[model samples]
Target chain A: MTRLLGLDPGLRFTGWGVIDAIGNRLRHVADGVIATDGELPVPDRLRVLHDALVGLFSTYAPEEAAVEETYVNRNGSSTLKLGYARGVALLAPALHDIPVSEYGAMAVKRAVVGTGAATKEQVEMMVRRLLPGAVIRRADASDALAVAICHAHHRTSALKVATGTRMA
Target chain B: MTRLLGLDPGLRFTGWGVIDAIGNRLRHVADGVIATDGELPVPDRLRVLHDALVGLFSTYAPEEAAVEETYVNRNGSSTLKLGYARGVALLAPALHDIPVSEYGAMAVKRAVVGTGAATKEQVEMMVRRLLPGAVIRRADASDALAVAICHAHHRTSALKVATGTRMA
Candidate 1:
């Protein structure tokens, strides 16, 4: 079984979910958000995010990690804030020597819900169906699960291709 | 004397400078850049930057840290890229429990060169004169030193204010 950690990073709230993937099967392990206070300075806020992520890594010990590749937002400042949190999300996993992969939002949706334009509800519903008893409440956590599922699918397909090549 | 570390963060090369501030006097301690490979994935690159910074914090053991408050870049992608590196720059010191300060470019120029409109050469010349042998070669290291100087000035003034308050 391959343990995976998925992260959806934001300055205000960074949502995360963990799952285990063995071949095509995925099992929900955990999901939640790491929130930082708005009143704190950016450095302090980033430290909060960083510390929480490091804690999660130690608790779950996920073998691999996945993060959603954010699209360019129209608002420059918000995008920059997101970038700060996303940096921690990516860095925390790499710091622990876990390989990190990124998936676009579209790819995550297609992998989880069978469509690129699936609504949040659709994604959440499928997240439940695929990983039974996944107690995802927030949109951010559900989205994180979606990305983890996407990684699982991609990794499984890559493994298949490798095996096929070896056989050939 | 208070030891200070100042950082000017970039994805390609993060410039760092260390200085010691004693009342109105400043002494340059060390200066260098941390460069990451462009071909590496962002997470791995961030790890390289993070590791270099962690090493600096241990070596310098700075009591306080300062980072330049950057103006927004017009290009969206570039701004986001900068945000990622800046995040690490700010977080590293904070993680090490160092008090981190920020100064605008104008404030740094004013403190270092006695004018907000000081040219780059003027700032570099003043940094050398103020520190009395700061061997600054790169523009990035000079800017980092300038911010460190600005922090020294501000911190000195703040100390004076606190002293006055206590005396009163």
Candidate 2:
């Protein structure tokens, strides 16, 4: 069973999730947030994120990694901060030599909730139903879990087609 | 007479231009490309960009800073590299405590060439006309100068409105 990890990056908080896949079925493993408070400088915050991701990678040993692609923000400073956050997130996976995939927000939402324009609340609700017995506490955590689940769903379908197995 | 410095960043090269604002007149000071060979790693490339920008800042002592906003690519890896290039560019002005502004591609084209959808050649032609004696050696250098000229035009109009002065 291959495991996948998902990340949702932000300046102050980075959410991560891990899941194990067996054919089309996914088993949620763990999910949490690595948050840095405002007292730290940007580089220090990035360092903290790097350390947290290193710990998570060691703990979970996920086979693959994924992140949500970033977009432009009207606030230039905020966009710059987001870029820093993304750099740390990408660096962590690259250090482990894992292939990291990125999905747009719309793609993640569509894969999780069956609608490209699904609201965050709807996604969280669908994540709760889809990941049964998994106690999802944070919204960011749930979103991260949804991203991993989506990738697993996609890969499973692709594998079935490649193997000439008709998936219903 | 405040001077604005504009930068267009890339992994292998960073282009910069300086333009002075004298009342309603804009005068080009200097423009050049800091070229680095492709042998360096990403971190070294960033350090080279940072140091070159510091040298430029000290020499020009620009009153304001502006940069071209990053463009997203469909390829995730390409987008990531562009983000890194932009990060180094943003760090340069922020380190000097200069208030930096970012112009989107369309905004830059409009400010430089009188139309939002103006072609690159049109923008380059307008930049040459505005700075008749500039020694532009590369297209990227010209683009950087165009960004500077665009900001000059943008600020000139804003200054006129703020001071209730008539345009000549």
Candidate 3:
């Protein structure tokens, strides 16, 4: 079983999820949020996120890591904060030489629910339907799990082409 | 006297230069290097740079800040490191609400010596001529001064246009 870890990085909170991938089947393993205290300095808060991610990687030992692609917006400060959060998130898996795959939010939703315009709630519904028994508590965590499942499905298709085998 | 502090941020060394902008003249005030022992963890090194920059900002009380724009190459890791260093540099001035400006390397050189392709030695020579009494110990510091001088020249031109006044 190949386990995949997905991350959604934010300045206030970082969402993470793990999924067990066996052939074309993906099973939800764990998902949660890592929240840092708002009172701490930005750099210190970033350090907290970094340490927490390192702990997660050690506990789960996922084979592949995935992160949501960041986009630039009108507010320069907000964009900068996102960049800092991304830096900390990338550090976790890069330190252990795990290859990271990036996915856009729309692509994740489309892969899991078969619709590019699927809402967050719709995607969450599909994730629950597919997993059946996942203890998903937060919408953010469910989105992360969906992202992981998307990567697993995509990776399976890629492996088939590399092996010169056609999918049935 | 309006003083502009210039910064050249790097992973191993952070170079800083201060210049007094008086009318049409740019007089160099001080310059130095705050180098980290590269062996230290990146976060610890970033902390050192942050502290040093804060101390410099308070001591000099610069009215504005000018930073060199980052260059992207084929190596993704190098680009990421540059972005991290740039983030630390930007955060320092933002704490004091000082207006920050970014100048490309070629533009800095062109503003100082009338040629974008000028060598580092040529730029240093012009910087010494522009401020005869200033001491320049590091090449990085000199480069930073050139950027400050560039911003000074740009602001003077912009101010002239805003006021609709002709220069002597």
TM-score of chain A of each: 0.97, 0.94, 0.94
Note the Cα lDDT for every prediction shown: 0.90, 0.79, 0.80
lDDT of 2 at A89: 74
lDDT of 3 by residue, A1-168 (tens): 899998988778888999999888878889999887889656556666777888888999998988877655545555656666765676567666677788887888888899889988899999898777898998778877888888887898799887775544
In terms of lDDT, the poorest run of 10 residues in model 1 chain A is: A71-80
Show pairs that collide, candidate 3: none
Task: Show model 1 residue runs off by greater than 4 Å.
Answer: B166-168
Whole-model lDDT, candidate 2?
Answer: 0.79
Ranking by lDDT: 1, 3, 2
lDDT, candidate 2, B1-168, per-residue tens: 999998988777778999898877788899999876688545445556657887999999998888887676555555555665665576566656676777898989998888999998898888888887877888888888888877888888787787785543
Q: Report the C-alpha displacement of residue B12, candidate 2, in angstroms.
A: 2.3
Candidate rank order under DockQ: 1, 3, 2
lDDT of 2 at A37: 76
Clashing pairs in 2: none
TM-score of each: 0.96, 0.55, 0.57
TM-score of candidate 2 relative to the true fold? 0.55
Q: How high is each candidate's interface RMSD, in Å?
A: 1.1, 6.7, 7.6
